[model samples]
Target: MDPSQQKHFAVVDYVIFAVLLAASVAIGLYHALTGGRQRTTREFLMADRSMGCLPVSLSLIASFQSAVAIIGVPAEIYSNGTQYWFLGCAYILGLLIPAHVFIPVLYRLQLSSAYQYLELRFSKPVRVCGTLTFIFQMVIYMGVCVYTPAFALNAVTGFELWAAVLATGLVCTVYTTMGGLKAVIWTDVFQTLVMFAGQLAVIVVGVQQSGGLSEVWRKVQDGDRIAGLDLNPDPTERHTFWTLAVGGVFLMLSLYGVNQAQVQRYLSARSEKEAVRSCYMVFPSLQLALALSCVMGLVMFARYCGEDHHTSFLATSKKDAVVIFFVMDMLQGLPGLPGLFIACLFSAALSTISSALNSLATVTMEDLIKPYFPTMTESRATYLSKALAMSYGLLCLAMSYLTHLMGDSVLQVALKIFGMVGGPILGVFCLGLFFPCANSTGALAGLGTGLAVIFWVGLGSIVTRSSGSTPLPSSCVANRLAGNSTVILQAVYSNVTLSRPSGLKRFYSLSYMWYSGFSCSAVILMGLIVSFLTGPLKEEDVTPGTVYPLMGKLLCFLPEHLKKKLCCVTPLGQTISACQRQPPHQKENNGEAFHRNEELDSCLPEEVSLPLVEQETFV
Candidate 1:
């Protein structure tokens, strides 16, 4: 709390921070002037679907890799040891499935909004439900993303919290409104670099200050900061291999698979191959991001593990602000370093906020608005899209105020929001894409059930303040205390076993990591049950290119005839033969605008209308 402990930025630091915001706006202005002058919904929302793999890949990572991860990951590792690092294991299956499975299905659909697939595969109401669910998820998440950096800075450097929030929101709004998706992607590319540089600077300096890598490693090892694979299978165990790796796959699917933000990037790619490649590219970069944050936590542990300075700040600090406190402490006297890190924090925030605003605009225009006003002029539509982006950006600033009341770690809060809301959204997509028999009624029922269950679990965990398990006390802190070894062991035993919740509380104690997996499973299970009860959809009635043949492939040993009867009535990627037999009147009524376009027939079903945005033929 002392003024002496506060970090003060030099003039160079301010200049660096200013450049980040200024450069972001400049990119927006540049994009606004070129690229059709942001005049069409396609250019504004889909980047004209002309992006290559590189920028799309970087933007994909930046979508969810916000200040929440920047500050939260290190603090998590510091407090809980490196057990969380095992989540990297999830990225393998997480990204691969999206690349090969999700990308192929969604990309071929040529959707402007991811929810459009829901309408094609299910019904219009289902599509609207999915859009609304996504809106709810991102609006809440934008709050955390925008508020995290500002909150952290305020705690350590006396930065004005609300002022920072407004600045971030306004700048992000301006750029997102002006430049649209292109600006959002380009800014993401540039901001991603700044994010890496800032974290690298802190890690490089922290390692040097902590007596270099070897000494730092020795300290962390001695302090028991390096965790081994905890192959615990208990659902209540928070950071076990199963919880993080297994459950984390579902979390990744929720983010990278069905979330509109990432899906928009996948759709914006020049081709399906480019989109898939970008998903693959995300793997290495994501691992690197995780490693950097984890290593920073180790460096922090080495420097301050048992020190009184660590104890003093922690006692007075909000748990989420620990990383900022450490960063400011380490970079205090360095001329431009403090500013660079601040820029890094805001870069992460702005990139995420910008992506969110643009995606929100895209979905609102494509899914919610244009569908109703099919005849809306392109110019008016583009203007409305910009207005939506600006509106959401301002709403995000308001949501940040609500975030101030929450007491959870920023990282946990963000992930919880993803799992609780995103899980159901992912579930609905999975039901529509993989279950040929799933009907609109079933999709609606399953989504409703998944959201209800996940919210109950998520809210209960918060109210009870138990994420099913607590981090074991740090050995560094333990070693410094004067205590009998047996007594300490007994105390830990009591905390782990005796303090465990029971019955309903035990249900609430389910690990937050399992939220997405658990809720997604509920949706699938409920969907199938309801579908069969409501007269399962005939596979022949399903849209082309929507079903992924997951069941058929998984049961490949079955006879071909049996596979068709059990898995699906038609082969994957096959257009409905019935479409060709339909009368001209029927075809027109069903919105079969692409029936004459043979190249599009493979993905475009007879039932769905053309997307409001331009549908270019993929090479």
Candidate 2:
């Protein structure tokens, strides 16, 4: 297992993964055994409404950062540079939009899944449709989140790919299944620290090995790898400001606001205000973390291209493997540093897995299970929630077999799917919030059209193209012009094939930054048109009785009707508004009160009543 032996036979790398995998297993098993019947909906999923801001924020960072950032961001930096990080500013915006807008709305509604907002804004079928789509998206993405790094770990470290994917997937899935949000949040806090330390270790130790930051910068400058702030127009280039900012803004909207994994963290906050604050904190942290990783990528590239550096990237199957390769070969000297670095890799995996599982479970109970099981008691819902989490995790673990085929790593693949799904998803929400003319029928039509467009963009000819028995690597002309490489480096590079092929190759560039943009535009345009043609997507008619949350808050005035609406304080059960009690004066005006009572009754069914937040409908 000597890292010095060959590119993949690194003993230190294996030791790192092995130790972490063991720890994951121990954690998952411990939670399962100790968790017991605490598997109820509120406790298992949302941590019994007892989560604080700081830990929740830390967990939020971990849950969203996942293997995609670990593999994709560094790979992106290796290919591009710090300029690509301009997208982080867009991410900051996405994070802020949700904190100020979406999170508060959801907290007021007190729904489980964001898609439940779809119900409020659209219709029953639309809610179910959105929910199902989310499930499909989560299944594939959770698989990628688990599979990608395991695939990379095995590819570079010479472990069994199947075993690696399974090993990682099983542990993440289990703890998420057992401990729910609490486990994910607590474990994610630890993992986030691990991930940060790991990246810092690579940067510090890699730079030192390559002489110093000065040498690294010199190599980057000499190699012409520093992508200038070329704000000018370039239709042909992949990572431009236009695409990065607009595209990144859309990506953030889908990723941070709409995506269950990212949004779930906010849902677990102590209060709506707390949720908003935690979300606000997430983007800044994400920006800083990504910026640091991008810096580390430069260090890795410097080592690989240095005059003294003998490593050959031409020998590797994927250029994205550079960071991992550097760790295994170039930066192996620091004692225990490798172990910490490896631990960070798991942090990425665990954070993402936790988010996906928790979100999946939330959506399942809120959207799918709640519909037919109207009589589902709080106790019953809780039981169903844990079972659903564990079951879905197992399904994904089985699907990890496909992980070996996804060599592009997690970020690129996730973005590809997210673009197709995320943009439209965000658009659907936008239609709900902004475009009152939008209706369920139009929303449905727009969703289909948007998905179709993203599918065409992301998976070109995957439909018309016949399914092949073998996977051949794709070939593309290496754009030395954009990357600022020498004329000689501009030669075309082809996707290489191992003995195995993915038959599922994408013709698009691996740059995930553009996905959010493509999706958002398509969905936004299509959704608006569809809504305009049909009718108002507004859930309630504009009248004195309506509760206009945003406008009311913005105007610094709560509507008289809304203020008069009865607020009932009840125990956690089938009734909504566990926090407020019904006053005698308010009880007299029972019409508005009855609407919420009906909504609460819907959640309780004939089953046990769980503590739920109040429900309000706005025009």
Candidate 3:
């Protein structure tokens, strides 16, 4: 290693890092001891459903904002420019829809796993399919989460990679198994603070060391790193306005709307209102997180402008480690800063993996194990749940070994994984909630078809990195020694060429941002078509609680005759009448009523009502 690239840590730096891990373990032990003498699955999985909005909100952010985003976002900005920042725009619809639509439906059901909705809406097979898909997705994702920081720190700072991985895996597993959801959420709260503090410290010190914000801004601008919205409508464009804003909404929906990790948080909230408020709270903090990473990239670009570290000791290091290299170099004189940054990275990884372990255990017990063992005792189930948590922790550690094989930017890789798997899952939920006519067969077919399409595209893109997108300009390497400008100009011009990819290659190479949107649309389209052809669901057979409230109003704009054809009152054991409107209190017997018919208008025709015999039987 080049002498300049080597980083040395002081005792104070080690102390700072140790304190973070100790505090997290302490929090877990506290929760373990403080809960009732006997631990229940509810206490372990849902925090007994007694959590406030603040902790849940913070924990939600911590769940998704792993070290991948912390390090990858900056690396993305540093390499590809700030065009990727437009993903922030998608957060608007992404979270809002979950707050109103997903939160209400799942929270009311009091589900232990989000896949429970699949069984309620479709069949047990569908639920198992959904649960298995989520398990595969999270298991693969946890490996990447655990591997990112350890690999990066090792590359840049000579930290022991296996040691870091084992420490994080063991610590996360201990807390998740010992303390459960309460420990996960509260530790996430503390880790979130540490994450922010560490990043903020780096950004503050980086700006000062780089000769101030004005100089940094000027340098980045000169290098053409300052980006504006890419208004191109091309789906093949990597990071355009439409892809980031519109496609991002689908990605966010897949993650925030239906993913088990977030669904668990929603079910843990004290009330429906609190759950919604917690989602709303995510906006500001998430934006701040995005901004901090972007600014960190700008400062890095400014400091390293025109300096070719690629030819230095870091030539063999992964791209993700570049951020660590710059940080250690900039903070060398300042003891403990590097350690804080490492803590931030590990903090991000640990929080995310801990959440994953707890949620995985919840789904395994609720969706898989408990269903088969209906008569099993609660104490035995709780013990089994803890065992499942430990098992997943081990699995995640094993998965970390595979992450070394992944190609492309880690941010894009993570997003691609979500889009490929999560898109179909979201589509299944959408079919259940938005289209009451969709049956189990259609849902199963749609999920299968969607997954097939996304994997085809995702795998093709990985195999051939010729995505037809324009390559980013090389990093600005400062010419420290006096050099010939003519030689530099000749070398740059020599690399300029124009070539177009084959049509099929281009199609397969469509921007990853469109993966979720395309897959979701494929599922919905295939599902509806298959459902209609294979005998659509009867209104009497549909569960009222499974349908979203907005679906009815969305169809209300149609003509009354058309509305009658499309909309029918779901059978809930109520009396049938000839298009008679009922008062609110009479219609909804209690809070269990999924739909609040505030309009009190008869929207369906008389013929839509089920016979009295069938109505009683359905109830």
Scored by TM-score, the top model is 1
RMSD of candidate 1 to true structure, Å? 4.9
Candidates ranked, most accurate by lDDT first: 1, 3, 2
lDDT values for all models = 0.83, 0.63, 0.80
lDDT of 3 by residue, 328-392 (tens): 88888999998999899889999999999998998888778877777778899889999999999
> In candidate 1, residue 146 scores what lDDT?
87
Taking the candidates one at a time, how many backbone clashes does each contain?
A: 0, 19, 4
- For candidate 2, the per-residue lDDT at 60 reads 76
User: What is the Cα-based lDDT of residue 612 in candidate 2?
Assistant: 41
> How far out, in Å, is residue 131 in model 2?
1.3
Find the number of clashing residue pairs for candidate 1.
Answer: 0
> Over the full model, what C-alpha lDDT does candidate 1 score relative to the true structure?
0.83
- The digit string of per-residue lDDT tens for model 2 on 475-521 reads 12222355545543434333232322333434333235565566666
